[model samples]
Structure formats: structure tokens, C-alpha cells
Target: MVLDPSRYQDHRTWKMTPGLLRARQPYFRNNMIGLAILAGVTAGIYSYTYRFLHKDNDFADVPIPPIDEKELEQLKKEYEQHKNERQ
Candidate 1:
């Protein structure tokens, strides 16, 4: 019998046919295709986010001043004093 040419490219139609599904049992056995598809989608989304963050310059507009060392030392001493009192 002549093979149906369309079945070669069409996944849904090809799976429905007895010959293809039965013949290729090893391809669909333990959810291999599903997991591969999920992994590919995750990788694509991660790459897209990385490119967007690196290319954007929105953070440049926000000025960040240097932290005051003296004030930070005072806060740390206060925190330690409070912990000591609690204990």
C-alpha cells in the first residue's frame, strides 16, 4: 500500500493512524516529549528576560548616593544594645 504523504508532517493525524502509533511505541512511552517541550519553553523565557534586563537603561535615571558610614555604625550599636537588653 502507498503511504499517506500528509501523515509524515502532521503530528495529530499521524498519531491517530494505527500503523504510525503502533510502530513508534518507543517515542511516546514515558512523557519524554512533554518534558523536552517544557524545558525548551523555560529556556526561551529565561533568555528573553536576561536580554531585556541587560539592554534597558532605566536604572541609570535613579541616582543612588553613597551610604553614610557613621550612621550605619550607630545603627549597628543600637541593634546590638537592644538584643543584649532582650537577652
Candidate 2:
């Protein structure tokens, strides 16, 4: 037996439907929290990948202290005496 669409159409009321009632209520549509989370995760992944890619090289920029001339001369003298003693 086939069902008649016209008989059910007359009994269907838009005012009593749960879907229509829920659609009329205000909803929280702001996605700022989700966006911030995504941004943080993306930044963390990018920074880690960049660090891994440059791990083998000395990329850190640090200041060097001045070397003393006396220390250099003393090291040279010690090396010369050791070499002479070995011969």
C-alpha cells in the first residue's frame, strides 16, 4: 500500500517542530578560543620543525670574549718546549 503525502502534509505544524524551535534560539558562534588553540599548535609545530632543521649548525648568536695576548704567547711557548723535548 502506498502512503498519501497530502494526508500527512495537513497534520504537520511548523510551530510544534523541535528543529524549528531550536533554530530560533541564540547560539554561541564565536570561534576565537578554537582559533587561538589552532594558532598556538601551529606555531609550536613550526618552531620545532625549524629548530630541528637547523640543529646541526651553530645558529645561536653569542658574544665572544677578548683573548689575551699573554695567554696566547704562553701557550705557544709551552707547545715549543714540548715539541723540543719530544725530539
In model 1, the runs with Cα more than 4 Å from the true position are 1-30, 59-87
Q: Estimated TM-score per prediction?
A: 0.34, 0.32
Candidate 1 clashes between residue pairs 3 or more apart in a chain or in different chains = none
lDDT of 2 at 53: 89
- State the lDDT of candidate 2 residue by residue for 1-87, as single tens digits: 354334324344423355544664444244666788899999999999999988866745766778799988998999999999999
Range of the 10 consecutive residues with the lowest summed lDDT in candidate 2: 7-16
Error of 2 at 67 (Å): 28
lDDT of 1 at 58: 79
Q: Write the per-residue lDDT of candidate 1 for residues 13-72, one digit (tens) a residue.
A: 544566666767876755787898899999999999999989999778998887799988
Clash tally, candidates in order = 0, 0
